[model samples]
Target: MTTPVTIVGAGLGGLVLSRVLHLHGIPSTVYEAESSPSARTQGGLLDIRDYNGQPALETAGLTEEFRKLILEGRQAMRLLDRDGNVLLDVPDDGTGGNPEVERGELRQMLLDSL
Candidate 1:
Protein backbone atom coordinates (compact mmCIF):
# COMPACT_ATOMS: atom_id res chain seq x y z
CA MET A 1 0.00 0.00 0.00
CA THR A 2 1.20 3.53 -0.77
CA THR A 3 1.50 5.86 2.18
CA PRO A 4 -0.59 8.98 2.08
CA VAL A 5 1.07 12.35 1.81
CA THR A 6 0.50 15.22 4.21
CA ILE A 7 0.43 18.75 2.87
CA VAL A 8 0.52 21.99 4.78
CA GLY A 9 -1.69 24.87 3.71
CA ALA A 10 -4.40 24.81 1.08
CA GLY A 11 -2.94 27.53 -1.05
CA LEU A 12 -2.29 27.16 -4.78
CA GLY A 13 0.85 25.09 -4.40
CA GLY A 14 -0.52 22.75 -1.79
CA LEU A 15 -3.78 22.27 -3.59
CA VAL A 16 -2.05 21.59 -6.91
CA LEU A 17 0.22 19.07 -5.24
CA SER A 18 -2.74 17.28 -3.74
CA ARG A 19 -4.55 17.17 -7.06
CA VAL A 20 -1.52 15.84 -8.89
CA LEU A 21 -1.00 13.17 -6.29
CA HIS A 22 -4.62 12.17 -6.44
CA LEU A 23 -4.41 11.81 -10.24
CA HIS A 24 -1.60 9.34 -9.72
CA GLY A 25 -3.77 7.22 -7.46
CA ILE A 26 -2.16 8.57 -4.33
CA PRO A 27 -3.89 10.17 -1.39
CA SER A 28 -3.04 13.35 0.44
CA THR A 29 -4.38 15.49 3.23
CA VAL A 30 -4.20 19.27 3.12
CA TYR A 31 -4.09 21.27 6.34
CA GLU A 32 -5.00 24.88 6.30
CA ALA A 33 -4.92 27.52 9.02
CA GLU A 34 -8.28 28.87 8.02
CA SER A 35 -11.35 27.21 9.48
CA SER A 36 -12.94 27.03 6.05
CA PRO A 37 -12.52 27.98 2.44
CA SER A 38 -14.58 31.13 2.84
CA ALA A 39 -13.38 32.00 6.34
CA ARG A 40 -11.43 34.99 4.97
CA THR A 41 -11.37 37.18 1.93
CA GLN A 42 -8.88 36.25 -0.73
CA GLY A 43 -8.35 39.41 -2.66
CA GLY A 44 -5.76 39.85 -5.34
CA LEU A 45 -5.10 39.38 -9.03
CA LEU A 46 -2.54 37.11 -10.56
CA ASP A 47 -1.19 36.92 -14.06
CA ILE A 48 -0.93 33.28 -14.94
CA ARG A 49 2.00 33.41 -17.30
CA ASP A 50 1.91 30.98 -20.16
CA TYR A 51 5.41 29.75 -19.44
CA ASN A 52 4.97 29.30 -15.73
CA GLY A 53 1.59 29.08 -14.08
CA GLN A 54 -0.11 27.79 -17.19
CA PRO A 55 2.25 24.82 -17.43
CA ALA A 56 1.78 24.02 -13.78
CA LEU A 57 -1.96 23.97 -14.15
CA GLU A 58 -1.63 21.80 -17.25
CA THR A 59 0.45 19.34 -15.28
CA ALA A 60 -2.29 19.26 -12.66
CA GLY A 61 -4.85 18.67 -15.44
CA LEU A 62 -6.72 21.86 -14.67
CA THR A 63 -5.79 23.99 -17.68
CA GLU A 64 -9.34 24.06 -19.03
CA GLU A 65 -10.83 25.06 -15.68
CA PHE A 66 -8.09 27.59 -15.08
CA ARG A 67 -8.78 29.22 -18.43
CA LYS A 68 -12.39 29.67 -17.45
CA LEU A 69 -11.40 31.73 -14.41
CA ILE A 70 -9.37 34.21 -16.43
CA LEU A 71 -10.81 37.71 -16.46
CA GLU A 72 -11.30 38.86 -19.99
CA GLY A 73 -9.46 41.98 -21.18
CA ARG A 74 -7.58 42.14 -17.89
CA GLN A 75 -4.30 41.90 -19.71
CA ALA A 76 -4.88 45.36 -21.12
CA MET A 77 -3.21 48.31 -19.45
CA ARG A 78 -3.89 52.04 -19.47
CA LEU A 79 -2.19 55.09 -18.06
CA LEU A 80 -3.96 58.41 -17.43
CA ASP A 81 -2.60 61.82 -16.55
CA ARG A 82 -3.97 64.33 -14.03
CA ASP A 83 -5.92 65.93 -16.85
CA GLY A 84 -7.55 62.56 -17.54
CA ASN A 85 -5.67 62.17 -20.77
CA VAL A 86 -4.76 58.68 -21.78
CA LEU A 87 -0.99 58.49 -21.87
CA LEU A 88 -0.86 54.89 -22.87
CA ASP A 89 -3.40 52.29 -23.82
CA VAL A 90 -2.54 48.72 -24.51
CA PRO A 91 -5.44 46.51 -25.45
CA ASP A 92 -5.53 42.83 -24.71
CA ASP A 93 -4.93 41.14 -28.05
CA GLY A 94 -5.12 37.76 -26.36
CA THR A 95 -1.49 37.16 -27.15
CA GLY A 96 0.03 38.63 -24.04
CA GLY A 97 0.70 35.07 -22.89
CA ASN A 98 -0.24 36.22 -19.39
CA PRO A 99 -3.89 36.32 -18.58
CA GLU A 100 -5.26 37.69 -15.34
CA VAL A 101 -7.42 35.76 -12.89
CA GLU A 102 -8.80 36.60 -9.48
CA ARG A 103 -7.00 34.90 -6.64
CA GLY A 104 -10.19 33.99 -4.85
CA GLU A 105 -11.85 32.60 -7.94
CA LEU A 106 -8.80 30.60 -8.88
CA ARG A 107 -8.64 29.16 -5.39
CA GLN A 108 -12.26 28.20 -5.52
CA MET A 109 -11.83 26.53 -8.89
CA LEU A 110 -8.88 24.53 -7.60
CA LEU A 111 -10.84 23.51 -4.55
CA ASP A 112 -13.76 22.38 -6.63
CA SER A 113 -11.48 20.28 -8.84
CA LEU A 114 -10.31 18.31 -5.84
Candidate 2:
Protein backbone atom coordinates (compact mmCIF):
# COMPACT_ATOMS: atom_id res chain seq x y z
CA MET A 1 0.00 0.00 0.00
CA THR A 2 1.23 3.44 -0.81
CA THR A 3 0.49 6.32 1.47
CA PRO A 4 0.02 9.66 -0.20
CA VAL A 5 1.74 12.83 0.92
CA THR A 6 -0.42 15.82 1.75
CA ILE A 7 0.85 19.39 1.90
CA VAL A 8 -0.84 22.58 2.94
CA GLY A 9 -0.48 25.92 1.17
CA ALA A 10 0.86 26.71 -2.28
CA GLY A 11 3.55 29.01 -1.01
CA LEU A 12 7.19 28.59 -1.94
CA GLY A 13 7.99 25.87 0.60
CA GLY A 14 4.85 23.89 -0.16
CA LEU A 15 5.31 24.18 -3.91
CA VAL A 16 8.95 23.18 -3.67
CA LEU A 17 8.08 20.18 -1.54
CA SER A 18 5.42 19.08 -4.01
CA ARG A 19 7.77 19.53 -6.95
CA VAL A 20 10.52 17.55 -5.29
CA LEU A 21 8.09 14.80 -4.36
CA HIS A 22 6.87 14.61 -7.93
CA LEU A 23 10.42 14.59 -9.23
CA HIS A 24 11.10 11.38 -7.32
CA GLY A 25 7.88 9.71 -8.50
CA ILE A 26 6.03 10.33 -5.24
CA PRO A 27 2.34 11.11 -5.16
CA SER A 28 1.30 14.24 -3.29
CA THR A 29 -1.40 16.84 -3.14
CA VAL A 30 -1.09 20.52 -2.18
CA TYR A 31 -4.07 22.19 -0.54
CA GLU A 32 -4.08 25.97 -0.83
CA ALA A 33 -6.81 27.97 0.87
CA GLU A 34 -6.55 30.65 -1.77
CA SER A 35 -9.15 30.26 -4.49
CA SER A 36 -6.40 30.64 -7.06
CA PRO A 37 -2.70 31.34 -7.40
CA SER A 38 -3.43 34.94 -8.30
CA ALA A 39 -6.10 35.53 -5.71
CA ARG A 40 -3.91 38.28 -4.25
CA THR A 41 -0.58 39.97 -4.77
CA GLN A 42 2.37 37.74 -3.95
CA GLY A 43 3.94 40.90 -2.47
CA GLY A 44 7.30 42.64 -2.20
CA LEU A 45 10.71 41.21 -2.84
CA LEU A 46 12.60 38.22 -1.45
CA ASP A 47 16.28 37.87 -0.69
CA ILE A 48 17.29 34.29 -1.33
CA ARG A 49 20.60 33.62 0.29
CA ASP A 50 23.27 31.62 -1.46
CA TYR A 51 24.09 29.50 1.56
CA ASN A 52 20.48 28.60 2.18
CA GLY A 53 18.21 29.20 -0.78
CA GLN A 54 20.72 28.31 -3.48
CA PRO A 55 21.13 24.81 -2.09
CA ALA A 56 17.39 24.25 -1.99
CA LEU A 57 17.01 25.36 -5.59
CA GLU A 58 19.80 23.05 -6.63
CA THR A 59 18.11 20.17 -4.84
CA ALA A 60 14.93 20.96 -6.74
CA GLY A 61 16.83 21.16 -10.05
CA LEU A 62 15.79 24.75 -10.52
CA THR A 63 19.12 26.46 -10.10
CA GLU A 64 19.38 27.70 -13.66
CA GLU A 65 15.82 28.92 -13.78
CA PHE A 66 16.12 30.62 -10.43
CA ARG A 67 19.28 32.35 -11.49
CA LYS A 68 17.56 33.82 -14.48
CA LEU A 69 14.94 35.41 -12.24
CA ILE A 70 17.33 37.26 -10.00
CA LEU A 71 16.67 40.99 -10.02
CA GLU A 72 19.72 43.20 -9.87
CA GLY A 73 19.78 46.13 -7.40
CA ARG A 74 16.73 44.86 -5.55
CA GLN A 75 18.84 44.02 -2.53
CA ALA A 76 19.87 47.64 -2.01
CA MET A 77 18.69 49.10 1.28
CA ARG A 78 17.82 52.69 2.04
CA LEU A 79 17.00 54.37 5.33
CA LEU A 80 15.33 57.77 5.69
CA ASP A 81 14.19 60.02 8.50
CA ARG A 82 10.56 61.04 8.96
CA ASP A 83 11.33 64.24 7.10
CA GLY A 84 12.60 62.18 4.15
CA ASN A 85 16.20 62.94 4.98
CA VAL A 86 18.54 60.20 3.87
CA LEU A 87 19.94 58.53 6.95
CA LEU A 88 21.77 55.76 5.20
CA ASP A 89 21.87 54.21 1.76
CA VAL A 90 23.45 51.05 0.57
CA PRO A 91 23.28 49.91 -3.03
CA ASP A 92 23.44 46.35 -4.23
CA ASP A 93 26.94 45.69 -5.47
CA GLY A 94 25.91 42.48 -7.24
CA THR A 95 28.10 40.54 -4.87
CA GLY A 96 25.76 40.31 -1.92
CA GLY A 97 25.30 36.89 -0.36
CA ASN A 98 21.61 37.14 -1.08
CA PRO A 99 19.97 38.34 -4.25
CA GLU A 100 16.57 39.97 -4.37
CA VAL A 101 13.79 38.79 -6.61
CA GLU A 102 10.20 39.77 -7.02
CA ARG A 103 8.00 37.71 -4.77
CA GLY A 104 5.39 37.26 -7.46
CA GLU A 105 7.93 36.08 -10.01
CA LEU A 106 9.30 33.48 -7.65
CA ARG A 107 5.84 32.22 -6.76
CA GLN A 108 4.80 32.07 -10.38
CA MET A 109 7.97 30.26 -11.34
CA LEU A 110 7.45 27.66 -8.61
CA LEU A 111 3.82 27.24 -9.60
CA ASP A 112 4.84 26.84 -13.21
CA SER A 113 7.52 24.35 -12.27
CA LEU A 114 4.95 22.29 -10.49
Candidate 3:
Protein backbone atom coordinates (compact mmCIF):
# COMPACT_ATOMS: atom_id res chain seq x y z
CA MET A 1 0.00 0.00 0.00
CA THR A 2 1.19 3.49 -0.80
CA THR A 3 0.73 6.29 1.65
CA PRO A 4 -0.34 9.75 0.58
CA VAL A 5 0.38 13.15 2.03
CA THR A 6 -2.31 15.77 1.96
CA ILE A 7 -1.50 19.43 1.76
CA VAL A 8 -3.73 22.47 2.15
CA GLY A 9 -3.39 25.90 0.61
CA ALA A 10 -1.38 26.75 -2.48
CA GLY A 11 0.88 29.20 -0.81
CA LEU A 12 4.67 28.99 -0.88
CA GLY A 13 4.94 26.13 1.64
CA GLY A 14 2.19 23.99 0.16
CA LEU A 15 3.29 24.59 -3.41
CA VAL A 16 6.87 23.79 -2.62
CA LEU A 17 5.91 20.51 -0.99
CA SER A 18 3.73 19.58 -3.95
CA ARG A 19 6.53 20.25 -6.38
CA VAL A 20 9.02 18.16 -4.45
CA LEU A 21 6.57 15.33 -4.16
CA HIS A 22 6.01 15.42 -7.89
CA LEU A 23 9.71 15.20 -8.51
CA HIS A 24 9.79 12.02 -6.46
CA GLY A 25 7.01 10.50 -8.57
CA ILE A 26 4.62 10.86 -5.64
CA PRO A 27 1.03 11.89 -6.34
CA SER A 28 -0.54 14.77 -4.45
CA THR A 29 -3.21 17.40 -4.76
CA VAL A 30 -3.20 21.03 -3.62
CA TYR A 31 -6.37 22.30 -1.99
CA GLU A 32 -6.72 26.03 -2.33
CA ALA A 33 -9.79 27.68 -0.88
CA GLU A 34 -9.71 30.48 -3.41
CA SER A 35 -12.37 30.10 -6.08
CA SER A 36 -9.96 31.40 -8.69
CA PRO A 37 -6.31 32.23 -8.94
CA SER A 38 -7.02 35.94 -8.90
CA ALA A 39 -9.70 35.70 -6.25
CA ARG A 40 -7.61 37.85 -3.93
CA THR A 41 -4.44 39.86 -4.09
CA GLN A 42 -1.39 38.16 -2.59
CA GLY A 43 0.57 39.77 0.16
CA GLY A 44 3.58 41.99 -0.27
CA LEU A 45 7.01 40.79 -1.35
CA LEU A 46 8.95 38.23 0.69
CA ASP A 47 12.61 38.14 1.45
CA ILE A 48 13.50 34.52 0.81
CA ARG A 49 15.75 33.18 3.49
CA ASP A 50 18.98 31.71 2.21
CA TYR A 51 18.70 28.52 4.28
CA ASN A 52 14.98 27.94 4.03
CA GLY A 53 12.96 29.43 1.19
CA GLN A 54 15.77 29.40 -1.34
CA PRO A 55 16.60 25.78 -0.65
CA ALA A 56 12.95 24.81 -0.89
CA LEU A 57 12.60 26.55 -4.23
CA GLU A 58 15.69 24.76 -5.50
CA THR A 59 14.35 21.41 -4.44
CA ALA A 60 11.05 22.16 -6.20
CA GLY A 61 12.93 22.89 -9.45
CA LEU A 62 11.70 26.47 -9.57
CA THR A 63 14.93 28.29 -8.84
CA GLU A 64 15.50 29.40 -12.44
CA GLU A 65 11.90 30.30 -13.10
CA PHE A 66 11.64 32.11 -9.80
CA ARG A 67 14.62 34.22 -10.79
CA LYS A 68 12.58 35.77 -13.58
CA LEU A 69 10.00 37.07 -11.11
CA ILE A 70 12.72 39.00 -9.36
CA LEU A 71 11.78 42.62 -9.79
CA GLU A 72 14.72 44.70 -10.87
CA GLY A 73 15.90 47.22 -8.26
CA ARG A 74 13.26 46.03 -5.83
CA GLN A 75 15.95 44.91 -3.44
CA ALA A 76 16.62 48.53 -2.67
CA MET A 77 14.66 48.47 0.57
CA ARG A 78 14.10 51.52 2.69
CA LEU A 79 13.40 52.00 6.38
CA LEU A 80 11.03 54.80 7.21
CA ASP A 81 9.64 56.19 10.46
CA ARG A 82 6.06 57.17 11.22
CA ASP A 83 6.61 60.59 9.69
CA GLY A 84 7.32 58.92 6.31
CA ASN A 85 10.72 60.53 6.16
CA VAL A 86 13.58 58.72 4.46
CA LEU A 87 15.26 57.05 7.37
CA LEU A 88 17.40 54.72 5.29
CA ASP A 89 17.54 53.63 1.70
CA VAL A 90 19.53 50.64 0.53
CA PRO A 91 20.15 50.51 -3.19
CA ASP A 92 20.26 47.07 -4.73
CA ASP A 93 23.52 46.78 -6.62
CA GLY A 94 22.53 43.43 -8.11
CA THR A 95 24.90 41.75 -5.73
CA GLY A 96 22.53 40.70 -3.01
CA GLY A 97 20.37 37.89 -4.34
CA ASN A 98 17.56 38.87 -1.98
CA PRO A 99 14.85 40.37 -4.21
CA GLU A 100 11.46 41.91 -3.55
CA VAL A 101 8.79 40.75 -5.97
CA GLU A 102 5.04 40.72 -5.59
CA ARG A 103 3.91 37.61 -3.74
CA GLY A 104 1.27 36.86 -6.35
CA GLU A 105 3.79 36.78 -9.17
CA LEU A 106 6.11 34.51 -7.22
CA ARG A 107 3.28 32.17 -6.32
CA GLN A 108 2.17 32.01 -9.94
CA MET A 109 5.67 31.09 -11.01
CA LEU A 110 5.92 28.41 -8.36
CA LEU A 111 2.59 26.96 -9.36
CA ASP A 112 3.54 27.04 -13.01
CA SER A 113 6.78 25.26 -12.25
CA LEU A 114 4.93 22.50 -10.49
Candidate 4:
Protein backbone atom coordinates (compact mmCIF):
# COMPACT_ATOMS: atom_id res chain seq x y z
CA MET A 1 0.00 0.00 0.00
CA THR A 2 1.11 3.53 -0.71
CA THR A 3 1.90 5.90 2.09
CA PRO A 4 -0.69 8.55 2.82
CA VAL A 5 -0.60 11.49 0.44
CA THR A 6 1.49 14.22 1.93
CA ILE A 7 0.48 17.83 1.35
CA VAL A 8 2.82 20.72 2.03
CA GLY A 9 1.61 24.17 2.97
CA ALA A 10 -1.84 24.77 4.41
CA GLY A 11 -2.67 27.48 1.91
CA LEU A 12 -5.85 27.51 -0.16
CA GLY A 13 -4.71 25.40 -3.11
CA GLY A 14 -2.97 22.83 -0.99
CA LEU A 15 -5.79 22.54 1.50
CA VAL A 16 -8.39 22.33 -1.27
CA LEU A 17 -6.53 19.52 -3.03
CA SER A 18 -6.13 17.60 0.19
CA ARG A 19 -9.78 18.01 0.99
CA VAL A 20 -10.90 16.75 -2.43
CA LEU A 21 -8.65 13.71 -2.25
CA HIS A 22 -9.86 12.89 1.22
CA LEU A 23 -13.48 12.99 -0.01
CA HIS A 24 -12.72 10.13 -2.38
CA GLY A 25 -11.44 7.95 0.47
CA ILE A 26 -7.83 8.98 -0.01
CA PRO A 27 -5.80 9.56 3.12
CA SER A 28 -3.57 12.61 3.40
CA THR A 29 -1.48 14.52 5.88
CA VAL A 30 -1.02 18.25 5.50
CA TYR A 31 2.45 19.42 6.50
CA GLU A 32 2.23 23.09 7.25
CA ALA A 33 5.40 25.07 7.77
CA GLU A 34 3.74 27.29 10.31
CA SER A 35 3.77 26.00 13.87
CA SER A 36 0.01 26.35 14.15
CA PRO A 37 -3.11 27.64 12.42
CA SER A 38 -2.66 31.26 13.46
CA ALA A 39 1.07 31.37 12.84
CA ARG A 40 0.55 33.94 10.05
CA THR A 41 -2.07 36.19 8.56
CA GLN A 42 -4.20 34.42 5.99
CA GLY A 43 -4.36 37.40 3.60
CA GLY A 44 -6.93 39.96 2.43
CA LEU A 45 -9.85 38.37 0.60
CA LEU A 46 -10.85 35.54 -1.73
CA ASP A 47 -13.45 35.29 -4.51
CA ILE A 48 -14.59 31.73 -5.07
CA ARG A 49 -15.57 31.28 -8.72
CA ASP A 50 -18.54 29.04 -9.45
CA TYR A 51 -16.58 27.16 -12.13
CA ASN A 52 -13.46 26.02 -10.31
CA GLY A 53 -12.89 26.75 -6.66
CA GLN A 54 -16.56 26.69 -5.77
CA PRO A 55 -17.13 23.42 -7.60
CA ALA A 56 -14.13 21.86 -5.92
CA LEU A 57 -15.48 22.87 -2.55
CA GLU A 58 -18.87 21.48 -3.56
CA THR A 59 -17.31 18.13 -4.43
CA ALA A 60 -15.57 18.20 -1.07
CA GLY A 61 -18.96 18.71 0.59
CA LEU A 62 -18.82 22.19 2.10
CA THR A 63 -21.22 24.22 -0.09
CA GLU A 64 -23.93 24.99 2.46
CA GLU A 65 -21.39 25.99 5.08
CA PHE A 66 -19.57 28.01 2.49
CA ARG A 67 -22.79 29.70 1.46
CA LYS A 68 -23.35 30.77 5.04
CA LEU A 69 -19.98 32.51 4.86
CA ILE A 70 -20.45 34.17 1.47
CA LEU A 71 -20.08 37.92 1.68
CA GLU A 72 -22.92 39.22 -0.44
CA GLY A 73 -22.46 42.67 -2.03
CA ARG A 74 -18.71 42.54 -1.43
CA GLN A 75 -18.10 42.78 -5.15
CA ALA A 76 -18.05 46.54 -5.19
CA MET A 77 -15.32 46.92 -7.76
CA ARG A 78 -14.12 50.42 -8.51
CA LEU A 79 -11.88 51.46 -11.36
CA LEU A 80 -9.92 54.57 -10.65
CA ASP A 81 -7.54 56.67 -12.73
CA ARG A 82 -4.01 57.60 -11.55
CA ASP A 83 -5.38 60.97 -10.39
CA GLY A 84 -7.61 59.20 -7.85
CA ASN A 85 -10.74 59.81 -9.87
CA VAL A 86 -13.26 57.04 -9.80
CA LEU A 87 -13.55 56.10 -13.45
CA LEU A 88 -16.15 53.50 -12.76
CA ASP A 89 -17.66 51.90 -9.71
CA VAL A 90 -19.81 48.82 -9.92
CA PRO A 91 -22.13 47.86 -7.11
CA ASP A 92 -22.71 44.29 -6.08
CA ASP A 93 -25.89 43.18 -7.82
CA GLY A 94 -25.41 39.53 -6.98
CA THR A 95 -24.59 38.68 -10.60
CA GLY A 96 -20.84 38.53 -10.28
CA GLY A 97 -19.05 35.29 -11.03
CA ASN A 98 -16.90 35.49 -7.92
CA PRO A 99 -18.05 36.02 -4.38
CA GLU A 100 -15.63 37.69 -2.00
CA VAL A 101 -14.96 36.32 1.48
CA GLU A 102 -12.41 37.21 4.10
CA ARG A 103 -9.34 35.09 3.67
CA GLY A 104 -9.11 34.08 7.30
CA GLU A 105 -12.80 33.22 7.45
CA LEU A 106 -12.62 31.16 4.29
CA ARG A 107 -9.58 29.27 5.49
CA GLN A 108 -11.27 28.52 8.77
CA MET A 109 -14.32 27.26 6.87
CA LEU A 110 -12.17 24.88 4.83
CA LEU A 111 -10.35 23.71 7.93
CA ASP A 112 -13.64 23.03 9.65
CA SER A 113 -14.89 21.13 6.63
CA LEU A 114 -11.91 18.83 6.78
lDDT of each: 0.92, 0.88, 0.83, 0.85
Candidate 4 lDDT, 11-113, residue by residue in tens: 8878888888888878899988789778888889788898998888888788888788888889888999999999998999988889988889888877876
Q: List the residue pairs that clash in candidate 4.
A: none
The collision pairs in model 2 are: none
Ten contiguous residues minimizing lDDT sum, candidate 4: 1-10
Model 2, position 110: C-alpha lDDT score: 87
> lDDT tens string, model 3, 25-76?
8888899999977898888978776677778889888888877877788667
TM-score of each: 0.88, 0.81, 0.80, 0.81
In the order shown, what is each candidate's alpha-carbon RMSD?
Answer: 1.7, 2.9, 3.1, 2.7
Best-to-worst lDDT order: 1, 2, 4, 3
Which residue runs of candidate 4 sit more than 4 Å off their true CA positions?
1-3, 77-90
* Pairs with backbone N, CA or C atoms under 3 Å apart (clashes), candidate 1: none
Cα lDDT tens digits, model 2, 3-74, are 789998899999888888888888899999999988999999898999988788788889889989999888
lDDT of 1 by residue, 2-114 (tens): 99999999998899999989899999999999999999988899989989889989989999998888888988899999999999999998788999999999999889989
Best prediction by TM-score? 1
Comparing candidate 3 with candidate 4, which one achieves the higher TM-score? 4
lDDT (0-100) at residue 13 of candidate 3? Answer: 89
**Root-mean-square deviation of candidate 2:** 2.9
